[model samples]
Each structure stands twice: as structure tokens, then as C-alpha cells.
Target: MVTPRLIVFTDRRQAARPLDEVVNRAIDGGARVFVLREDDLPAAERAELAARLGAMVAGAGGRLVLEEGPELRKCHGLADLVGAAEDGVDLATLSPIYPTRSKPGYGPPLGLAGLGRMALAVSIPVYALGGVDSPARVRDCLDQGAAGVAVMGAVMRADDPARFVKELLTA
Candidate 1:
């Protein structure tokens, strides 16, 4: 039932540098957790990548939540969150707290109120997602009762991923 306060998700398509490099720098910048979202890779490739990142982070006392991996299940809405808890997931991600470029038309965008309600409605930990890039937004999510925050595109596209990690950690 332990979860880190920040979880950085990977999106290779938007990466400004190699994922390992970005993740390594993030780790160096104090990011202690990550979610491996490169699901497009074949099972073997994904497993290899996971093992590599897992080892790297493990040495730093960090960890990775693989997409659909046994460790964590990401939930996009309240119902999904409830179901995940019922199915034994300890934590999940709830999204679109603001408009995001990553999912252009995917949502009408739930604000902080939605995040609060969802967190209150579920027993398991919930991480706020979507448009949560800056320190202020990260603070806003925590204020609304999010257990932590999860981010992808912003860090993935950042020219200085380490600095990005440091900025978010300041929240």
C-alpha cells in the first residue's frame, strides 16, 4: 500500500532524448518512481526494458509500475478506480484535471473538484494526471486530496527532464 508522491510516466513518442537517459536524469534529480508505458513494444522487448529500468531504479530505492503489470493498475475514472480496488490494486491514476495536448479530444477535462470527489470516493490511493506539469498545479492536486501526481507528456517533451523533475518535486 506504499506509493511514491510522484510518478513519472514514459511516452517514447514524445521523448526529447532516449528514455533511459531521461529516466536516469530524472532519478538523478530525485524522481524515485516511474510507470513504463511503452506498451507498443512486444512482450519480450517490454520485459527487457522494464528489467533494465527496474534494476536502475531499484538500486536507487525507486521502482517502476509497468503498464498492466502486477504492481499497479491505472484508472481513468471513479468507476475504474473502484473496480481496481476491488480487484486488489493499491493505487491508480485519474486524469484530465485540465486540458492536455496529449489527449486532444479525449476529455471535457475534469478539474480539481473532480479529483477531490474521486479521491474521497475511493479507499485506494489516487494520483492526479493530465496537465499537471508545473509546481503550482502539482500543489493544487495535492491540496485537492490527491495522494500524488502522475505526468507524462511534459517531462517526455522537456528539453531538461532533470530540471523538470526537480521543479515538480518542489511542489
Candidate 2:
């Protein structure tokens, strides 16, 4: 089994680089999933990126999470996921949930108890995102019922991104 490794949340801020390179690096970094959260891009751009990313992740035997926008309500299985994030995603996530480089004044993090409630409410597996900065937080989320943690800065800003991911996988 893959041991449910880390997921990577790639947003519009990262669109400047070529999608192939970005996804390739993430795959090499032991990321088992990728959630494309590029809200600023037009539908065409988003779909284009999604198609490319989906191919890459699927080729590597990983899943690609595409935020369905308000369309999530229109989708069959995404409602629960949408609900969890609205509730206590961080709590569900274990520690810092948002990315460290996120815009200042992001909402407060949801601790373990809060996330546990979300886990109870939702059917699909939940992965903690946002300011996840430590290995301990990763362990905590797993213990608290999150499927895994998704990182942005922790891996993106590192010197050896793939190696950093390996460390995270082992951690």
C-alpha cells in the first residue's frame, strides 16, 4: 500500500510555472494526491491545468482533487468534502492547516477536536491543509482521523523539494 502519503495543494499563485514541471516535481516528492485550487484562473485555464495534472497524477497512481467551485453542490460526492472544510478543516488537519505563504489574516486553525467532529460528519476522507509546518502535525492528523496533510510552502519553498517530501513520507 502507498501508506496514504501527503497531498499537495497547488493554487493560482503557482500557475506561472509550466504545469508539467510542477506536477512532475510533486509526484517525485511522494505526493499521493494533488488538489488544484486555482480560483483566479478562467475556466479554460483551470480545465487545461486539470487535464494535464489529472493525467500526470493518474499515471503515477495518485489522485487529483479538483475544487468544483459552487459546482460542488452539483457533484455527487463532493458535498461532504465541502462541508468538512467549511466546518473545522484545520482541526481535521491536525496543526497548521493553511499554507504559510497564504494571504495574511487567514482564519484561525481548527484543532483536533474540531476536526474530529468534521470526520464524524463527513463520509469521504479528509486531508488537513493550510499552515501545516511540522512532522508532528502530520502524525497528529493521522491519529486524529485525517486521511493526510496537504502542503504548499513546506515542499515548494524547500531546497530539495523531492527529498523534503521523502522525509515527510517517512516522518
Candidate 3:
């Protein structure tokens, strides 16, 4: 849809370093879309972080999407898919398309068929999220009709985020 081939999800708790530091590295590594998923922060704090991240992403000619907001560009889990278009969402991420330790307990994995089903159901671009850690998985998701893939641990925990992102983008 929007042509963002790779979206990096941020979780403060799961990060190995400061969120900004990790995100900056990712941006340098070719990540074009970033989703702020820190739900535990107070509203004001979250907004502040979003503003900061927005600036960073913009500097890299990328985009930033908040997990919670009235923003036109947004990311959503499968359960939130029903009214995404009505809510004015430009992009949505239907998650757990495969089993993932990064987002355990959300529900069962959607698999390829379910991913395709949801992708076809929504007019907005649907990104496959969860357990999409490899280049092959990225290709698989794209083949299944996903506009792209959203990842957490794959890039966040990587020793070389730039290289990891480059591999994903090239794949």
C-alpha cells in the first residue's frame, strides 16, 4: 500500500537499549515505518515520545505510526480490523500471522490463509506481524498478499540492526 517495505515495532520493555537509540539505529539500517507500541506510558509521555520519534523518522524520510491515536496512519491487530477504514486508518498491521515469542498470548497464529483472507478484506494495506524474523519469512508474507511485514525482536534485538534491516529489505 504505502510502499513501506519494512516496519519496526518498538517496545520499551523489550528493547536492549534506549528506545530512541534503537529506533535511530533501525532508521539508519533502512527501516522506513515505525510503530510506537508503548502502551504502559502515561498519555502525555506517550505523546511526547511519539513527537520525538516522529521527528527522527521524518529526518530519515520515513513515517511514524502510533498504536493508539487518531492518526490517519495507524497499526492494528487482527481484532481491531473490523472498523479500521471507518476510523480513517491508512495502514493496518494484522498481527500474529505466525507464532511469535515477541507477542505471545495474543491468540493463535493467523497463518498464510488467514493473512490473505484479512488482506483481501481490508482496502488499506495489511502488514503481517509477529515472528517475521527472516528474509524468507518476509518473502512468504509478501507472497501471501501482505503489503509488508512488521517486526519486533527481529530487529530490536539484533546486534546489527542496519544489516538485519538491509537483509529484510533486499529480501
Candidate 4:
């Protein structure tokens, strides 16, 4: 099966613009994978949002993943990687690969070597997350054996999300 190389993470709290607008723009600009990381929303609201986003993503020939909530199909977070693997998750994100302002207090950044080790340790595809705002960073993650790179602030805060996503995909 094909895996997305560029994944956009959504956090309503960190968004400078409307979340849906940013997401739609990114999708239009070729972002094929998205992780709904809005942990602040109530369960019902979150599920509703996920359903809506899931439909949108599917219509665009993409995939939507949920950050650790009720969704048992996929998982996100470095600590959950092992459990996710054991639960048969095919694609997982191991985050904070680099220092990121988006996720404060998550812990110290895991450098390239750490990322490489985690990627090697996992049997499933590992997408690097955190501080991935540029093409070079994306390349670095790929070089370190990551299946892809996931980002939040980079696209969500862009003045032109579509253009940003286009540039990111090219990178």
C-alpha cells in the first residue's frame, strides 16, 4: 500500500487562521494525509469533526488519522509507538523529532540519531513530527529513514496555505 509522504497535523489551539480553511487549502494544494490532533474538544465534537474531515479527505483521495482518542485504527505519539505496533497499526507518527514550539512541555527534542533509532526500532512506517517546517528538514527526516514528515504550525499559520503545501510537497 502507498503511504503519504506529507502529513498535515491539525491543532485548533495553535491555528492562527480558521482550522477548516487551512486544512481545505492544504488539501487543495496536495496534502494527502492529515492527523486530527485536537485533544481539547469533547469526545462527541471531536468524533463529529473527525467524521467530517474524514469524508473530506476521502473525497480528495486522502486519509485522515486521529490522535490517541477512541480511534483504535491508528495511533500518534512516540510513547504509543510500541503499543500501536503491537496493536497492528501499519502507520504511526513518532513525534518531537526536533524542538518545536507547537508542542511545548512534551519533553526535550529527539535529535536525528534518536529519530533514526526509533525508525529502526519500529516495524511499521514511522513519520517524523515536530519542527518540520522546511524542505531541508523533510529531506533530513527521509534520510534518517522516516516514512514521512508531519507538521502543524508550518501550514496552519501560513499566509497562503495552498502555496505552502505545494512548496512542501515539491520538497
**Per-model lDDT:** 0.86, 0.61, 0.82, 0.80
Q: Where is model 1 more than 4 Å wrong at Cα? A: none
Residue 124 Cα positional deviation in candidate 1, in Å, after optimal superposition: 0.8
User: For model 3, where is the 10-residue window of minimal lDDT?
Assistant: 69-78
Ranked candidates, highest lDDT first: 1, 3, 4, 2
Every model's TM-score:
0.94, 0.69, 0.87, 0.86
| Candidate 1 per-residue C-alpha lDDT over 72-145 given as tens digits, one digit per residue, 9 for 90 to 100 | 77667888889987887778888878889886665677899999998889888889989998999999999999
List the candidate numbers ranked by TM-score, top first: 1, 3, 4, 2
Model 2 misplaced stretches (Cα beyond 4 Å): 1-3, 12-19, 69-99, 120-123
Question: On a 0 to 100 scale, what is the lDDT of residue 106 in model 2?
Answer: 49
| Backbone-clash count (model 2) | 9
lDDT, candidate 4, 68-161, per-residue tens: 6333233344458778777777677777888888886677778788788878787878888889888888888999998888888888888888
Q: Which of candidates 3 and 4 is the stronger one according to TM-score?
A: 3
Better model by lDDT: candidate 2 vs candidate 3:
3
CA lDDT of 77 in candidate 4? 49
Top TM-score model: 1
Tens digit of lDDT per residue, candidate 2, span 16-129?
A: 455566667768977776667786888898789889889888999997766553312111123445565565342223334433555334445566665656555665556666
- Candidate 1 residue-wise lDDT at 48: 97
